[model samples]
Structure formats: C-alpha cells, structure tokens
Target: MTDEPDDLSDQPPLVQALLLARYTLVIHSGMRAVSEGETWKLDFASQIAEIDAALQTAGIDTTKPMFAPVKW
Candidate 1:
C-alpha cells in the first residue's frame, strides 16, 4: 500500500500521449493476446483505438520517434 502512484498528467502532453500509445500497442499486441479471452480482445482494441483517435484529435504526433532507432 505504500507504493507511490505514478501520474501520467505529471508528464508533458506530448510525452503522455506517446507513453499511452506505446502502452496501448504493447497491451493490444502482446500481453492481452495470451491473457485475455476473445471478448476482452475486442474491448481492448476498441479502447485503444479510442485513445489513439483522441490523441490524434488533440494533435499529438504518432510518427515513430526519430531518436528511438539510434537510441535503442
């Protein structure tokens, strides 16, 4: 119970958007596939899609980070 809560709002808007996008991609493609059943997959995809749409509507860039390749 002592674990501190991690708040995304503490991050910049663009960074928050990018972090959400990264998490959505990973959960949709990786963990959910094995851990979730059929019904949950659709729900998860729908939710992720909504988040992505909202991020785009807010003008957050979705392009792959240029520095990611070099840094990784």
Candidate 2:
C-alpha cells in the first residue's frame, strides 16, 4: 500500500473509526503472534506503525471506541 495518508474524510466518522480500529487490530495480532512462538521476521511491523500513524494524522481518533459500552 502507498504510504500516502488515507483520505477517510469521505466516509462517515463511525466507518473511518472502524477501519482504523481494524488496522490497529491487525498490527496488534501480528505483535501477539510474534511474541507467541512465531519465528518469522517482523519487518512489516514498522510499516504497520506507519500506517497507524497516518490514520491518526488523518484525524481518526484511534483511542476512542466506535460503539457504546454494553450495560449488560
């Protein structure tokens, strides 16, 4: 993927948030896999970090939840 900042302004805020969250989850999963007995090189981790940074720069609030907390 190009390193250009993703133009997520056209999407609804919730959709943009969800997409960012998905990318974040993918990076986290890769990190967990590497920590849990995986021997493959993790060269892509830096790229993932860059992407997450770009997403944040694009104004998506990565720290906020997309949905309300369940009361149950």
Candidate 3:
C-alpha cells in the first residue's frame, strides 16, 4: 500500500523474512536468465550478483530455495 521499504528493520519479522525470500527468488531468476541469455546481459548478471552478495552480507540464508524459479 505504501512506498517500498528502504529498511527492513521497521517491518515485522515475517515481512523481513518474506522480503529476503523474495530477493533470493529474484537473484535465482536473474542467475538462470543470465545463464540462458546473451553475453550483453553480463552487466545485468553482475548487478544480480551484487544483490545476491548484499543479501548474504545481511546474513540471509540462501541455501534453502524460498520461492520457486520464476517462470518468465
């Protein structure tokens, strides 16, 4: 309903977990896409990798798949 949250601390635990899960899902999808797409997408892949790293730096556990791979 409101603008996207910039900080997850203010959100509830369930929200925080869900957001992290969503980010994980996006990262997974991007990875798969970059793998299948053309070389120019390397830039996009790098950005996705950065997001993935940031999520990890925040201590998000990415070992477990949260949402399924996005069917684009």
Candidate 4:
C-alpha cells in the first residue's frame, strides 16, 4: 500500500476508543451467541464486514499494531 495520510493511528483518541469498543462488543456477542447454539444473525456479520471495508478504504493498516508509541 502506498503511504497514506489517513490511517487509523491518525484518528483522534476518542474515535479510536469508540471504534475498539464497538468492535469488541460485536465480536464478543457474536461469538457467545454462536457458542450457545443460538441462530447466528447475518446482520452482525454484515456489520463486521462493513467495518472491515470501511477501515481498509480509510487506508488503515489492519495488519499493524493499532496502539503504538505516539511521538509527540
């Protein structure tokens, strides 16, 4: 990927926190429901896919460490 100015690390702290929280909730709930033999909802899976797409489109490096030392 070419060097992109807009990366996940470039986002504000609050935005990062919110995104992480949302991701955690969705993944945790989805896993629990599946493990309990509950019918999995496609909506949750779609949301995750959407999130992944959005992140990728935003030039965010999903493969790298999200929290790195910020040199101020």
Candidate 5:
C-alpha cells in the first residue's frame, strides 16, 4: 500500500493520449483472438481514432522526442 500512484495527467498530452490508447486495448483484451484484440478491436480502434482527432486539434506534435521509436 506504500506504492505511489502513477498520474497520467502529470504527463504531456501526447504521452497521456498514447498511454490511454494502450490502456483501451489492454482493457478490451478479453474479447481478443490475438494481440489484435478481435471483437473489441474496432471499439478500441474507434476510441483511439477519436483520441487522435482530439490530439490533432490540440496541435500536439507526435514526432517529438518523447514519441521517437525506442530501440528497446
């Protein structure tokens, strides 16, 4: 119970959006046939689509360093 809470809001908007997308997929994983997450795939995909639109409107640059491809 001594663990500190991880707050998403404390992160930048792009970071928050990316984590939210991952979270949506993970939560919908139960309906999956693979990592692609079968039945719930479209649901999460659409949700992410909305998130993408919002991010675009917010003018967040996803190409920033925080979003660069990781080697590991």
Candidate 6:
C-alpha cells in the first residue's frame, strides 16, 4: 500500500467544518488548564470566552465555553 497522505485542505465543505469544530474544541480545552494558579485560570477563562465567540462567528459549534468550574 502507498503511504500517501490525504490533503485535508481539499476536503469537502462538510468535512472541513467538522474538522474545524474539533480543532477549536481541542485548542480551547488545552488552554483551560495551563497553570494551576487562580490568576492563570481567570486568563484562560477570558481567552476561552473570546475564542468561543470567534468560532461561532466562523460557523463553528462553539456553543459552550471550555472553562469547567472546579469541583473543590
């Protein structure tokens, strides 16, 4: 079998949208717990909020913010 890779940039519109949504979610989640300090949490929360709006504007399903409240 050949080891050729598929070009995601040339994917179907629907497929591209799905991939974009997944990427946005992953990035937002990654930034949510960068530092353990409260200050970092606040910054991350703010960043997530902005990203959510931007993603929604770009037709992504960023309906929920990535900041999950601490259970402690």
lDDT of each: 0.52, 0.54, 0.52, 0.54, 0.53, 0.49
Model 5, span 21-68: residue lDDT tens: 755664664464545554433346666566656766766443232332
Write the residue-wise lDDT of candidate 6 on 1-72 in tens digits. Answer: 233533446556764555455545555653545445543322345555665566557665544322332235
Residues 1-72 of candidate 2 have per-residue lDDT tens digits of: 333444555567865665655655554554423456756543455555665576677776545433332235
Q: Which ten residues in a row have the lowest lDDT in candidate 4?
A: 62-71
Tell me the lDDT of model 5 at 7.
55
How would you encode candidate 1's per-residue C-alpha lDDT over 1-72 as one tens digit per residue?
A: 223433556557776765566565645553433344453332455666666677667665444332221212
Indicate the worst ten consecutive residues by lDDT in candidate 6. 62-71
Error of 1 at 21 (Å): 7.1
Query: Best-fitting candidate, measured by TM-score?
Result: 4
Q: Would you estimate the TM-scores of all the predictions?
A: 0.39, 0.35, 0.36, 0.42, 0.39, 0.33
Return the candidate ranking by TM-score, descending: 4, 1, 5, 3, 2, 6
How do the residues 1-72 of candidate 4 rate in per-residue lDDT, one tens digit apiece?
544333446677755754575456464653533556666543465565666666667665544434333457
* Residue 33 in model 5: lDDT: 50
lDDT of 2 at 40: 57
lDDT by residue for model 3 over 1-72, one digit each (tens)? 333334556546765665665566465553423345544321244555665566667765434434433455
| Better candidate number, 3 or 4, judged by lDDT | 4
For candidate 1, the 10 contiguous residues with the lowest summed lDDT are 63-72
Clashing pairs in 5: none
After aligning candidate 3 to the native by TM-score, how far in Å is the CA of 66 from where it should be?
18
